[model samples]
Target: MGESSWAIDLEKQITTAEVDEEEIKRWVIDLEKNMEEEEMKTSRSIFKVPTQTTLLHKNAYEPNIVSFGPYHYGKSHLQLMETHKKKAVDYFLKNYGKPLNNYVKALEEVDQELRDSYENLDDEWKHREKFLKLMMFDGCFMLKILYEYKETLAKPGSENHDHFNFDPQLCLYIRRDMLMIENQLPLLGLVTLAAVQTGKSTVLFVLSFCYFLKLESNSKNSPYSNYINSTVFAEHTGVLNLPILIMDEITEISFLNLMAFERKAKGMGSAVSSFLAFMGSLINSEEDARFLRSKGIIQSTLGNDKAIVDCIKLLGKDMYFNPHSEMCLTQYRLNQYYLNSIKSWNKRLRDWSSNFMQTYVKNPWTLISLMVAGFVLSLTVTQTYYSIHKPK
Candidate 1:
């Protein structure tokens, strides 16, 4: 609802998804697997051939990504997770007042109230909370911000943050793709910190990719960011940076489209079809998916020619994708897909209607089971609601 105010003084925020217990168990098992594999840094396959140049050579000149957002907003949290703060001396000294070996001993001497906040946790989030509190002591965000703006952290006479001065020219690539390039830094990233709700959290999660890119691009000259570094000095940049922003919000989209598509059927179709068509093209034609697959363009995968054509078609026919040859295949594909949507999925298409997920979920057997569950839940909720609102 609101950003977490330090003034409120709480341990954990006490908010979580209401996913089923089975889901929680699955989530924990995944976490364990992730943790167990955290130390892994290399892999190889029999089919893999020796490269003339490592990825470092190819990505050296790639554009860097930047978050272009506000403060708190879990920027630091995301940075720490990606950077792995627990692996270094600077992080150790910065996080716990004493060095790693003696920090716990010092903690033992501290006040019990303070100890409770740090030691009372039984899970990873509690550890995160304890870490965040430690951040307050030496400028919680300075390390991360400086790390991203590593050019600042690398200036000849760089001292604590105040001495840090960012090199404007070092950003040779504007990264017009997904990285937020600006005349100045903006505050969208910080305001989004409180987005724990499904809708907001989902959007916030997408922005983390942007943040990750920014850190990658900016960490070129960071003294401490050398986990990926190869130079004695900040010699080369962007080797670790991925110059892409691909939002495949597949899970979120299914529900959103159902709402928009339903509204369009009720005579709102014209008003909403453009958006539907664009999204449909975006997914089906697969611009990001194809680009990602080019292997040469990004990571290896097969290209989605349909998505490429659909995206080009959206730019309109007059602006032919190849004006010299006057190619307009994309426009034709757009027309074809839209026509297909209408011909195949419309209410008049009985065959299509029969195959829809809604039809499957609403079948007689499913209807009967849903009705029984609904009746039971209705009684339970009604009894509780009635009791709560009664004469009192």
Candidate 2:
């Protein structure tokens, strides 16, 4: 058929075709219902890592030694920790002198909300008994681990203390696994278990051993920056200061998962994401990484400067930045400072003045020489003035 004729025929057929109104309406209704359900799922804090991000670095987001919540629960590798979890439960009950059933009942009361906190929970975990059991076991295990971690911190000499039969390597693996986004249980479950066991909140228990790297802030509470002049006064300095980042295997894994979680969860600002983006901007080469290390800004045990740069590049992959975020604003300010010629010149002048003062005036001998020269110059000028008036 000719191209014009074929197009006309197709248009005619589509226009003349009978439409099914009822079926169309049913399809529309179904779509709306499904969309509403998906919208409701946004409240869920736990989620499978997006495929695009996972493709970049899959292992960073997956649990290794253990799984905490429904996302990675019951996987073959993670199943090895089940026996340990049970042992933790035993230790928890004996240490607190509480019946196991009481803790189970406590989690049972909030089980529905707990289930809703996770996205796309499996049918096996949907069973009330199984879900409550998981919560009780995992919560107790986490509490026990926290107690041990706290003790380990309190007494550095007790590293050999075999708590829950966990060796140092196993404990390290557990820490990395727990930091994964998909491997997090709802704090509600842990808090409920704590209240039932200790008759109080779980703030101390839950927050134990959870440390945060403090980012230095600027005048507007944004990320801290450096200025042209290192010795500039605090009030006049335009510095964006960042926290000293210690990059190793565990730190890399933890930050990757944290950035993923911050991306998945709503209303949580992209602080980590922004920080990674800023770091990526700074460290594009081994030389850049080495310079940062020399300044004590980046302490990397990740082998070499090249490895640090590569690690940062990996972290920055598929990451998003919120332009309105404080870190982004800080970056914008830095770019402005770089691009503004007037500001650059002003900073150069300040730096030159400060350097001049430090080099020439601040030294006792140099200051004395300048003072003696000035005094001699003044005396010679006075003598010349008298000589000129006397001659006249």
Report lDDT (CA) for all predictions.
0.34, 0.76
- Best by the lDDT measure: 2
Q: Kindly list the per-residue Cα lDDT of model 1 for residues 258-337, writing each as its tens digit.
A: 22223323232221233223334443445554654463322321144554444334322212122221112333444566
Report per-prediction Cα RMSD to one decimal.
Answer: 31.3, 11.3
Candidate 2 wrong stretches, greater than 4 Å? 1-42, 204-209, 212-238, 341-392
User: Would you list the clashing residue pairs of candidate 2?
Assistant: 224-240, 224-241, 225-239, 225-240, 225-241
Clashes found in each candidate (C-alpha, N, C closer than 3 A): 13, 5
The candidate that wins on TM-score is: 2
Looking at candidate 2, the ten consecutive residues that score lowest on lDDT are: 226-235
Error of 1 at 241 (Å): 29
Candidate 1 Cα outliers beyond 4 Å, as residue runs? 1-84, 87-142, 149-277, 281-283, 286-392
